[model samples]
Target: MGQARSQAEPVRDDSLLEGTIWTPLGSASFPAEQPLRQGHPPRTEALPERTATRTSRRCLAAALEAEKQWARAALGAIGDAVLTIDLRGTVTYMNRVAETLTGWSQREAIGAPLSRVFPLVDGKTHRTVITPGRRAIEENRTAGFALDCVLVRQDGSKLAIEDSAAPIHDREGRVTGAVIVFHDATRSQVTLERMAYLAQHDPLTGLPNRALLTERLSRALGLAQRHRHLVALLYLDLDAFKPINDAFGHAVGDSLLQAVASRVQECMRVIDTVCRQGGDEFVILLAEIRRPEDATRVAAKLLAVLGRPYCIHGHQLLVTLSIGISLYPDDADDADALMHNADTAMYHAKRNGRNGHHCFTAEMNTRPLQRRRTEPGLHHTLQPSQLVLDF
Candidate 1:
């Protein structure tokens, strides 16, 4: 009975502690109760801070790597050759285009001097420039001049190059190196020169056209005005050229005009310029003429040349020219006035006789002034005597 009472008392005490473990307000006890079956309810594991930090670092490194790859791809995609060199003239960077322009690969060109890799020459002299890189670096200026040079290829073939050089500068306003961009301008330059020549010259007769002739006449007049000298302007019209064109065809007419143009050029002095003013008309600018007789001599010489028959395309063409002379300052002041007076004088020569010469006079100006004021489209053949023909 004593042993049973002792066991019952211990059981009663355990029940009291269990009942107190959960209070009326559900407050927790001092020490957590461990389950008998499970070992301490498996203590919850917390994540380490170092592991999270390591994960974030890995993500940032991946982002940086992706950006670097994008930049490299962008640099490789450009068409123009890009080269970066140090101030000491050593090549530090070169793109794919650079490798293609110069036969040296980027691997071989890197760290090589620019002069040794791509040498340039003077255009006019064809001499190699010794220190182009040094000039760009020291001067801190850009330079661009025609350079006729040859590029040595990897396969030993030579490529002719016309290149322009420019200096590259840093953020500190100092020239770091130079970059040269060039292409084949051989065919293009020749085409341009031919076009320029054609613009200033007559395509048929190969003489100065109206535009160049006028420009030279203006300059000659200015010089004459300064030196108190006279300039002779002669206007010539082929009299029987139309008949030749009608009978023998346009090809014969063109041949006759070309022959006449050559003959007219031969009659004039070296200082004089003979210009074709389109369609059977020619103008001669006689520079530094002393007297009016000098112009008469030129007109006589032109008439003699044109009096001969031209044999073209198995046809003999005969043509005569009527010439009119006008003196600068004595006839008119400016280019327009001089040209108009000469034209009026030319018509007078044509009306007086088919083959003759007429000079501008003061009475010639009055008739044109009267015609301009009264009659707008009055077409009258002015005779040498009716309009002032004496200079």
Candidate 2:
């Protein structure tokens, strides 16, 4: 009966394993005793496929690494500073410029708080600046930093900086992090200020130039007309300046002009403006003076002060100015007329002597005020009436 029952049971084939194996063509399986055929590729044939897969994987990894290195190089080589932070406000990455500007290394700054990496303050208000990156991350938008912003570095040094922050996003358009780009704008700001200063001031003597003088004169005239106050304009020319310039080099001449400008500035009040018209000519605007005699006093004081000898570059030089005074309502009303009359009076002062002041009068204009230049010196000779022209 046991033999009969064993004969009734079907024998299971262990060699015919029900398992899948990778092949060169695809996945397949067969009995262990069966030879590999066109329908079923052998295990040995799968080696080429596996090797090719490995090679593809290695190539992909190498390309990704190269891309990462290229990105780092580009970031490091940029002129502006770059910093990145996660949504939690933790620093994630920093470029070379960012490291130098913030005084924090990437190794030291990574995983640190954003505030620790980038500390800022207002340049004018001296208050703590709010981080725009945090706002950008939270609001999911780009934000600009404050104007005239100053950055206080990790080592306690400070620099002027301008920066902006933008929210970074993933492929799905979800906000992932924030990027902050900044740069050192101190040099640029200083350059702009220097340019503006040069526009209105004489580069040689550091005095107000003709453009600035005219602007101030116009404003002063307006205020004087409104308040019924007197405004005085004193036109001055350095006597024999050309002869001295020709005798000495331009270096000595420049030094002499600077010295004269300094002396003239010292003789004026805080409310006055001393201007350099051009060359050795200067104009003084005495705004809101009490009386005409007030200008006379200033002129006398300037003559006394500037007439003194100046020691420059081991040479003692003496210079004097021929000043002409013009009043707002007394000489002429407008700025141009007042300036012209003052200039005419300055010529008269030159005609009288080298070191004196004259007040403008209508009679001074009646004569041929235009003078012809004589050779050998800056001596002037009165010309015909036709020679008179607008200054």
Candidate 3:
């Protein structure tokens, strides 16, 4: 369909629409000057049929132009980019957002190949990803880019985009063209990543937190169950951490913790997971363990590396860890129960001695519970708003 412009007439231009029929893609001339037309001749008995035909043609063109304007306005008002292409994959129209995103205006983008104007590639490998409009044409249905797709703009810069295209069909249900819609996804992706990090990580140490630890353990257990492998869960508590933080300042303590996390990572395999369970406590998961002794070996290595003196801002200080060990299947039924048993063992190690490791025993659970229950209460302390006795 073509857009109409105003003109005076017996419309010298034989075309039904005297004004420019604006379709670079459609069958019409763009904006131009029009020759003036004089008044029509008086009606005759024989001329009525011819007059009626011209009137019908004029009405049709006007209606078509109105439809074209409505479509353009609707597409332009959209916030997301919109691209339209003809059957040959040539770009037919692009709205304002599309122009900004592809860095090509409607005037320039028209008649250009969809790939030339809107190229996408693999975000990591930079390999050419299939152009969606062309793909839709080939598939004869809606098509979209894969995850981590990057759009290559006219200026040669890249942006993450989520876009899809569907073939436009003719009156007979034949695919005639395609319309694609897309939006920039960079900010949304970044926000999602940031939220994920904050939800599962310790802010001070940048290590996975208790919530993430449980998740990792669950996955590890699932894998171990399938592969019939041993999974080791270690809960570590830094020895003398409270006094070190109180005497050396919290800043130094945080620095030491960061250093400790770094060292711990270095000591483990890439398949392993280490998460901080808040404040001087960390959990490590070794998912590919072959035997029970594999955990003890790792515990020994961790003690050696973490026990090394840390020089934080010129203050030389030594630290050690008390680790609790629990094995999958051998210790507990589920990840949470496994970690709980490991945590109980950690406290057992702490009570018996500092800077050592303890394996979970059935009795360890009862001992810690008994200790907590027996600890003296502060019920004798005076409470506010209580009745006073005149002794």
TM-score of each: 0.55, 0.69, 0.53
Best by lDDT: 2
Q: Which ten residues in a row have the lowest lDDT in candidate 3?
A: 382-391
| Local accuracy of candidate 2 as per-residue lDDT tens digits, 1-391 | 4565467446344233224343454334545586455653334664576566666866998999999899889999998899999988899999999999999999999999998889889999889998899889888889999998888999898899986999999889999999999999886778899999999999999999999999999999999999999999999998777666766668988998999999889888898999998888899999888899998898898898988877777666677779999999888999999999999888888888769999998998789855633233343442222222323
Q: Where does candidate 2 stray beyond 4 Å?
A: 1-80, 86-88, 95-97, 119-130, 138-140, 146-162, 168-176, 183-196, 371-391
Better of 2 and 3 by TM-score: 2
Please list the Cα RMSD from the true structure of every candidate, rounded to 1 decimal place.
Answer: 17.0, 10.8, 13.4
lDDT tens digits by residue: candidate 1, 203-243: 99998999988999999999999999999899989875555
Local error of candidate 1 at 128, Å? Answer: 5.3
Give per-residue lDDT, candidate 2, residue 286: 97
TM-score of 3: 0.53
Show how many residue pairs clash in every candidate, following the order shown: 0, 0, 0
